[model samples]
Target: MLASHEHYRAAVAQLNSYAHAYYVLDDPIASDEEYDILYHELKAYEHAHPDHIAPDSPTQRVGGSVLESFEKHTHLQRMWSLDDVFDIAELEEWVARIHKSYPNAHFTCSPKFDGASLNLCYENGVLVSAATRGDGIIGEEVLHNAKTIASIPLTIPHKSTIEIRGEVVIPKEDFARLNAARTKQNLPLFANPRNAAAGSLRQLDSSITAERRLLFVPWGLGFVREALSQSFYESMRAIERFGFYAPKILEAQSTQEIHAYYEQIQQERENFSMMLDGMVVMVDDFALQERLGWTIKSPRFACAYKFPAVEKITKILSITNQVGRTGVITPVAELEPVEIEGATISRASLYNYTDIEKKDIRIGDCVIIIRSGDVIPKIIKPIESRRDGSQTPIAPPTHCPECGCALVQEEVILRCCNLSCKARIVESIIYFASKRALNIDGLGEKIITQLYEEGKIASIIDLYALSVEDLLELEGFKDKKAANLITAIAATKHIALWRFINALGITHIGEWASKELDRRFGLACFAKSYEEIIGIVGFGQEMAESFVEFSAVNHELISRLLALIEPLPTGSAVGSNMDSAMDSSGGDFASSAKRPLENLTFVITGTLSVPRDDMRERLENLGARVSGSVSKKTDYVLCGSDAGSKEQKARELGVKIITELDLEKLIGF
Candidate 1:
């Protein structure tokens, strides 16, 4: 007879599986938390049965896998990342700069999304597409799943063209249920709701994609023909008009008031369903945004003040290990799943043995796990209170988990067999075919995992050897997908030399390295001459040394890789202005332009009726950027009544001090 505890175990298993279908898959097969009660019951059983263990346990796997690749797509606008402010001082400094610019600069503070960043596209006010923040310029489209989000309205009131940008996130309770199901199914679980939603949104199939209950909150508009409001709140109401969930805005009159708003958000962390990573403070006026302008990346006007992450102390139940794409062995702590920042965190990465030693963490010892800002939970410290003699030190692995190859300990890292490890074969294949690299359209990580699990394809070299029969048998793949994968791989055979260089995933070389190489050498010569690279601009001793190390490390593979990508084209022949930037001196533009304010340095001090940043920008547009602190080089100080240090400094330096009115006259208003 099955024990009463076994009944609870079975119930828990059913609940978690259904939860996965509903939460992870976004296909709700059962009522919400129908599985939760079962999960709770199973936990009760586990508390009773410390001896009985389930191997295919949802309780086991760490959620979220780093995909080998993402398919590339053009962003409607672009998914620009927000510039960060570390502290309140930076925020205040930003406010002060604004005060100098626009006299009537009243600002609003909004809860900065603590979820996945996205760029959403709509045509005729109908939701059409969504993409991840891959780079600022390009992202992968996952519109099918994004459409299922009720909060992300399918149609808007506007008849004219419109597009918006926002984030997609999984709510906390839903995240827990999905994880419980994965635990029961013994499938790998998600690390957090944010990452989980991101992974789900990227799925290729519309049906598979629709399963994650993602919420899209339109933070700001993208490409809209007409202005919604004169200010930021009006824009929200406008987006709301189009049937999208607009974020709550906290309008503040002063910088002090803005700080008060952020403090309130911090105090109300758990009050909201979607997590609040930080506070995004911005001036409301559209004219002001135009006046302030932008940096190359972000708008000059806004800032995200990230909240101090919710942290809690928990016991390190035990230690475990996981093999990564490179076959590097990493230590992970199995913590007693504790609540912090609206989610239950059971695991934290120990990076390597170096990390293990640095923290001096031990099994059965108490440790503090911190979830700060946008999280990948980190270990803060050991509690020392729970240090019992029952704790044991975990030794680093001697062999690769998958291939059984001997492992080696580098200075701070642990490595398995260099070229031949199975972990690497899968990872390299994935990287070799990623969006920025070769971009094999149908080649998802799930497929690669299956191929690796089934022993159908072994190495990236083996990917060339894959036949029609090799891909057809994988679950969800069909005749068309197999053919498409094959065609994509064939097309990838003739790709950019920079893409080839980048696909190799060298230790420190990134997109920048490959791009730099493209500027110096075209594809054909690049493959042959990359080894000769040393002492170029930005190419330093360490980069060259790593290249030399890599040559020795992957000699045979590199040779094969060269053979595949050699005849392919290089990227654009446009030599980077960086290649020989000294060849032309455009510094003469500032010196050449007979500016009205050429030699004059203006330091704006004290509050004006307008934000100083706006005032500064206008002065700059007329060709005079404001100086922050007063110095001997300063030509004038724009003083307000409370002007303290800067006014005093200007006086000591014998500098001309101007009022806001005088300052405007100098800029030739």
Candidate 2:
């Protein structure tokens, strides 16, 4: 019995070490399969000897208790915010103020994650309760929801009582997926990840929190019964050793070092999984921090050096209606050229006619433009304070700007309704020839516009009918360039099934949905019943209905395009080792389904020699599903230069990771 107890303790220690390495360090010391084996053994031993099982066991992380409602709890320590510094001069002043008290003070800088703050209390190395940072002293109890976070360890190595303060955030990739799911359900989408995280945590049901996939990252100590280290850096390292994620810390001894560190973090913020608004600079020495003390609201020992705001004030020159590929006329704001967050802004999307009327936006009004992350510049609101009486209210267009077709108002959007509208045809062809779709190189927007205006290309099918001689009639066409474009158009005659489906530009059907549809139904997707289409995982009733509606409206167009384009045989859809067997048999159709990647899901990250879209196409062509985020369901991750959090998450989840060269080997590229 003693030997069995010793073995159980050993298993728990081993599992804790693996969790610390995977979660805190972003590195894995053991394979997931190996860890699982050990974890199961531990569970079995505990099951056999329940009396000997410790409360701090890793198996106790997932709680089964459900709560009726959240209760209010008082915090043991007050949670304080840090003073903000917007520029280098302000940061220098802060450093000077701190140095006056502690002449030899050094600082530790870490990311100021934009997220909801939570305070977690641990007793006897076991997590007892959790609460939000409400009013600094009192907070709503959320222990039930807190247990759902996988990154928050339910048990730690510390035997003393301790309270940890950390931020809860949803990663950017996960946020997109959550929003997409919400859109399919016709629910209002959360504006950003921070909002999503906060809403998820405040849910009455713990299951809702689990589904949102929130992560908790420790930043500072709230209270501790026993001191572990004398320096802040050392204390953070100790916290990490207890299996909690701590942000990357950089030590700076001088103002120049601090400035360089802040700049480095700002440049790399986008690559981080969580949203970061600034860097938190704090005195590294515990004694110095204690001596410096705090003000009524903020601590004097720490200050936040924030990055320049992505939002800027810009003037709207005019509002123009742009006809999309789907014939929906979207209002776009043409802005006076202004720089925001390193990019020059000239145009911002105003969404639809309803958005303009609701915001009271008008031509010649000054507007607040925001360029957050990789998203396009968007007008948040008009600066009505600076508006003069000369501002003209934008009226909805009565006719199509390009072809003079009568506009039809459908719900919140205005549409051209005419299939033969020149702008609609041009945009459709351009999208069909885009890199993510057919990948027809040399066919750009300008060239497509010229071809449509000259009546040489009226539809997507007309591109296949064009010859070098037909293109030579245009003003700027040269023999070599025209031949290259024709050749490029011909090369796109054969495409993957998913790309062909996405190229159709059906409403609510994006590249990801197209891939899912192809994986579920393959070539027979168009013929599937609405029930069958909606039954597929990750697809909803709205998408299935949209697909049926689109097919009914454009059946003839689809048939004509199918006649011109040959969709290459997919491994799962066609049933067999189609690539190799068909090649050996001189393109003979096979009978048996043999998809090597039938159940595989891949995620691509970082820069590759070929565009990421092209790489995704190649993988999907072989019957694989590509997702944006890494989860347990992910089969593999294709990593390239500068791969960031996705790669790290893959390692933590024990998903197979491959390089671009490795991917080529798998697909026989």
Which candidate number would show the highest lDDT if scored against the true structure?
2
Provide TM-scores for the models.
0.61, 0.49
> In model 1, which regions exceed 4 Å deviation?
1-73, 315-318, 354-366, 382-412, 431-447, 460-669
Q: Put down candidate 1 lDDT per residue, 70-148, tens digits, no spaces.
A: 5676775655556788677888788888888776798878888767777776666655667777866677766655655
For candidate 2, lDDT tens digit of each residue in 1-669?
A: 225788888887788778767655668899999988888888888878889887656676554566645789988888888888988899889999888877789999998887899999999888888999997878999988887776888888788888999899888888889999999999998867788999999987677887776889888988888877888889998987777887889999889999998889888977898788788898988778888898767889998887776888989998888998778999999999987643467899999989899999999999998875433578899999998798999999998897786676666888764445666787788888886677687897878889989989897878999999999999889999999999888766656666788877776687767866766677778877888888876666667877865665566777777778776534433322323332332331222243355547899987788778666655654557788889998989999886767988898999999997787677554
- Model 2: how far is 668 from its true place, Å? 94
Evaluate residue 493 in candidate 2 and report its C-alpha lDDT on the 0 to 100 scale. 60
Top candidate by TM-score: 1
Worst 10 residues of 1 by lDDT: 574-583
Worst 10 residues of 2 by lDDT: 582-591
